[model samples]
Target: MSGPPPAAVTVHAPLRRRVTVQGVVQGVGFRPYVHALATALDLSGNVTNTPEGVVVEVEGDPAAVARFCDRIAVDAPPLARVDSVHHQEVPATGDSAFTILASRADGPTRALIPPDTATCAACLGELADPRDRRHRHPFVTCTHCGPRFTIVTGLPYDRDQTTMAGFPMCAGCAREYTDPADRRFHAQPVACPDCGPRLALLVRRADEAGQPSPVTDGDPIAAARRLLAGGAVLAVKGLGGYHLACDATDPAAVERLRHRKARGDKPFAVMAASVEDIEPLVRLDPEERALLTATTRPIVLLRRRTDGPTVPGGLRPAEGVAPGSPDFGIMLPYTPVHHLLFGLPGDPEGPRLLVMTSGNLSGEPIVTDDAEALERLAHLADAWLTHDRPIHVPCDDSVVRVCDGRPLLVRRARGYAPLPLPLPLEVRPALAVGGDLKNAFCLGAGRRAWLSAHIGDMDDLATQRAFERAVAQLESITPVRPRLLAADRHPAYRSARWAVRNAAGRPVVRVQHHHAHVAAAMAEHGLDGSVPVLGVAFDGTG
Candidate 1:
């Protein structure tokens, strides 16, 4: 009786669709990832970066379209972590093929900005190849990986909007950057040895023309190794800003850097060579190692090793690194220069890692300019290990710790800021002037919150200028024009004054400092504020 069961029925409709893939898409290798997928599925569409997310108008075989839309998150790049993909049928414009278009500026910016990533394996191989023009070049990078938030002045992350603007790519690099097949395709920071950021060794001389010292000898790596081994202080320019470094093993030099910076009892952070170096210094399980080696390159605060013998004393490597803090802020090198710094000639054994800290006194912003660093940190550092690469924006180092089983942001700077924080309420255009200490600004519209990089504090004229600059630069990226400004009610808070002074037509909302902190947490936790909340208040004013 069931001879033919039932005739199979197929439903077919020529449907076109528009897909918006959101959450952490920009600078996390989303375009290339989508490009590969679109090509694989034989889709006829174009993908572009809008403020909210990647916009894709795919028109193809319905089955392939389904797979292309659904499988994106599953097949995302190792660095790209997609949170959601929304697809809806739309009137199709008959396009022949799928193309990745340049990012658009007017759309909603609900997507997160990605932090600077570590050098990719491909770039690393080329770093050592003599035939490669980028051989031993410290700033080698590609589209898949390189500096992101820190170096970027505005969004749509083109070379023109980056620190790489001054040093345009040469003919050879131009070809590579243009080629979709090449790794450097759309790499904003692409450069060759011919047209690239170069390093310079500086000494504080009476005249500017007086040649300090050329770091470029037969081998700059070897030269850096020699310079570092001699117990001299080196002021190094890094991802976030400038760093003052000294031999960790040499107590005297470490002591000197600490004293000169007027950082009396504060802890000094140490940059280690490997997880092996990290293990001997701090107790680490697999989780700690994983966090340390994460692409963010944040300063992971770890518990000090109580049992290790020959531990450096009151140099207090652990305590000094995170002064007045409960954890030790440790990090590994994130750049090729760092890799080669540790990989010196003959494999010398003088503790490859050193004490690396912000090149400034406590409570000040990081020094970016060589002349400024020399003038400000002259007494702090004996010598300088600077590069000619001009820093477009100032971004301090990010410090993190696992608190209450979650990654707590102690110092959110270069690696973490400018990323859009998903907001709970879709509020009007508003600017939140963050706490004066560990200062940053949050500009919000709809569900997106664009946080400025670490702007030191609202204390000095320099920091105030920096805050203004960061605000101006970030305003260029977002579509929102703030209608209101928010600041802490603290009497002496300079941010409050700045908000009052600068927000001309906007009314300022005065939120209590600790209340804002609690509110921020409650927002992230998705807790309703209608009911009365209980909490222990640590106002720090007994």
Candidate 2:
């Protein structure tokens, strides 16, 4: 038999604490979640977005307040990533209710903004449902999905600070935006067909004077698919930038794209409608499948099916797609527009797979500016399927490969920019200008280092200009004002030269390429130099 519980005693004193959270918290529904948590715990508090990250205040019983702080990261929204949370007891403010405050822009921005994510399951369901107002809408998004770093032009990541500012929300969207119960509440890129970015298709033709004339008019996705089926190359505007796409099955089309772009044997990435579509052509392990379908949607390199047909045979990818390589770089459709290209559910006549290569000439940075694409890619693209949503940053598609059942990132961009890498040791504000070949610069302060998105080879004049622009954009978002500069030791490397020329009054530290590579590996593993580790350098340079 259970005895009656003793009478509960009420605590008279109220406890208060302030918490400062860092990393990928802004534009990710952090404040609302904090509000809900604080309210549920019967705590009177306030939450606000700050440059350093989210700031929260809570006044309640000491135990409840502690639990509230502990569960913040554990119960954070799916898209909200909490890197670090710090709390300190403060004097009770005698608050009565929980509230969310306006964002503060005055602090040094150490807060890491999240990278763009793939369309979430909820958004995808709405995209395919005929009854949903956002059905087949190209720019459909929610708090758990859609653009972030690439679309963000300035700090304090809000709709007005992003490219989506041009499109105002309709009454329906506005309702969802304010409704706390709605998934899209406070989603920066939330919009619908009533007020959202629209696609436009343009075809190039020679005028009577033999000058190129671009004629714009068509149902963009349908027209682009039609052009692709007809062996025509289309320049497609993607989340981060443009992509040159064509039917992967058409050898002639692949060869034409290669010849026009002056690309050598470097393989192109193929975008399939789904994993089911590409399963027949490639061998996919559990890890490879996960990488392919991940929210980041990076191109994953997979071993080709050399030993005859796969389990469920369909059609094989054209030989021209990879040339000499034994692995195929593949990715699934990430954006709603990409899903539109393949058509809804059963209406099938279009190509199953597309050769989606970065939209640029061989040695240039990927094109993000629409006007520049028209002029520079005129010789390569026969048609253009573009949108009004401007990309504030030009980021190439990230590339990765599964080696020994683990993901190895080859080129980190697009879905992985502005996210800082944790360093083994704290350092002062410094900018590391990586080698000219792959040319990815890093801005570091304290223990966090942010690597710029792939800037392409710094040899090209256009690439150099792009490097400067990327640096400026990165500096705007990250509060690291580089007081010291670091560059490769190679005397003539363009990146090193750029460091010398642009160092202003800052000191430039030259690091040997081989030494730096060894150091990087050590740092990644958090080695403290207590023991000797063998390192081999094989960069292929004499």
Candidate 3:
């Protein structure tokens, strides 16, 4: 009876797996996502950030473990770029719950640092909501967005390794940071108004002998708005470096900035609050509009409309903003500070459009040090709107243009640097010190090459120092230790000279200028270089 007592019921043993995930995983909420996934599948596991990448160990039913492994890459966090995932079966640990462990630092660092991202919509909502605790917080950021490359000082990206190290979390933020259910969980730069960086407005006081004096009486943002409304240039400290901001609608202000910087009629980029704000000034196809509002928020070149809308007092983007140019380089607000600069609704109206140019003198690096900014930009800026946070590296704004319905990079920095490009064929480790102009160097190993952010021309000692610092920083996080060096063949090139000087007995390969240009194009298109191809090179000299 009853089929011989159900044939003596049998149970299968639990399965466990140890997994390793690499690529853009450290700072982008990968651990929280992993914890959530494991918990949802009723599995027990621990996830942690390591110098190498993210690692996870899970024990559960065989089917559930397989699902966990599959979803780790397929449904990773929005900002995470999971390049590879590996998992192997191991003995079950019988752990009761899933957890996120502190980052492990004892290893060779191969983790990819994420580029700084524009503020996400959720943070922007909190910024605008009066009922929210972070209302009007200039540093509103979550794990999804905000500073990464520029703020990172070391690997296994943690709060202590970032510029936010000095700003200890308050009780409320700490609660949010440790709770896996919360969005701010393990967000390195998480902060609230109660315990975060404060904004300060500085101006050169005649009584202080041209020294910058902080304004302690009124709100800094409101005071800054007034300065721009009065056609005064402001040196505003940003995520990476200082920006020289002025009312783009004011012709005198634009001309004053150009004259002060000795800019020779080169086009100046402008920042508006939204696409709608700039729609009247530029022709925006769907692709161009998407690019203008992308999370990276690069300066996009758009065809200018000759007959565009004018502001009150018949003010438009001044001719001095982009003299003799058919297009306007424009970008939307990328940071909470930038959004606050353009006032929120129901606040006093300020400059809806701003000339946000790099804060630098002619042929020099952008100013990152606050004291240095106060000294170097004193002659150019009428006021300084800065904060207490220190930028570890100087990154400039990236520039882009839409060509044939695709995004074409003109100057790759800020949003897109230190991200590796895949090579069609594997090659030995090497370091390429780029030309003297637009000196972004490269570090290559195997089939990948990592390019540094936009380091300025090598003519200035300051720029050369920046290049060296960037090279060292890039090498610290990557596995590439160059055994060979490449430089331009031009003997007078500063980049070449620096490469030869620092070769450390490694052979230095000199590449011809035009030939290198062709090779670069070929590499970009994934050509193997096995077949002969015709190439044409043209530049100012040619």
Off by over 4 Å in 3: 1-10, 307-315
RMSD in angstroms, all models? 4.5, 3.1, 1.7
Cα distance off (Å), candidate 1, residue 171: 4.5
Runs of candidate 1 exceeding 4 Å displacement: 1-16, 50-52, 81-96, 102-111, 128-133, 205-218, 310-327, 344-351, 424-426
- Residue-by-residue lDDT tens digits, candidate 3, 457-521: 78999899989988998998888999999999998999999999999999999999888888878
Worst 10 residues of 2 by lDDT: 209-218
Tens-digit per-residue lDDT, 66-91, candidate 1: 88878888888766668788889998
**lDDT rank, highest first?**
3, 2, 1
Kindly indicate the candidate among 1 and 3 with the higher TM-score.
Answer: 3
Index of the highest-lDDT prediction: 3
TM-scores vs. true structure, each candidate: 0.87, 0.94, 0.97
Residue-wise lDDT of candidate 2 within 79-195, one digit each (tens)?
A: 777888999999998999988777778878877789988989888899889999988899999888889888997767778889989988899999988776787878889989899
Q: What is the lDDT of candidate 2?
A: 0.86
After TM-score superposition, the amount by which residue 514's alpha carbon in candidate 2 deviates from its true location, in angstroms, is 2.0
Backbone clashes per model, in order?
A: 7, 0, 0
Tell me model 3's lDDT, rounded to 2 decimals. Answer: 0.90
Model-by-model lDDT, in order? 0.74, 0.86, 0.90
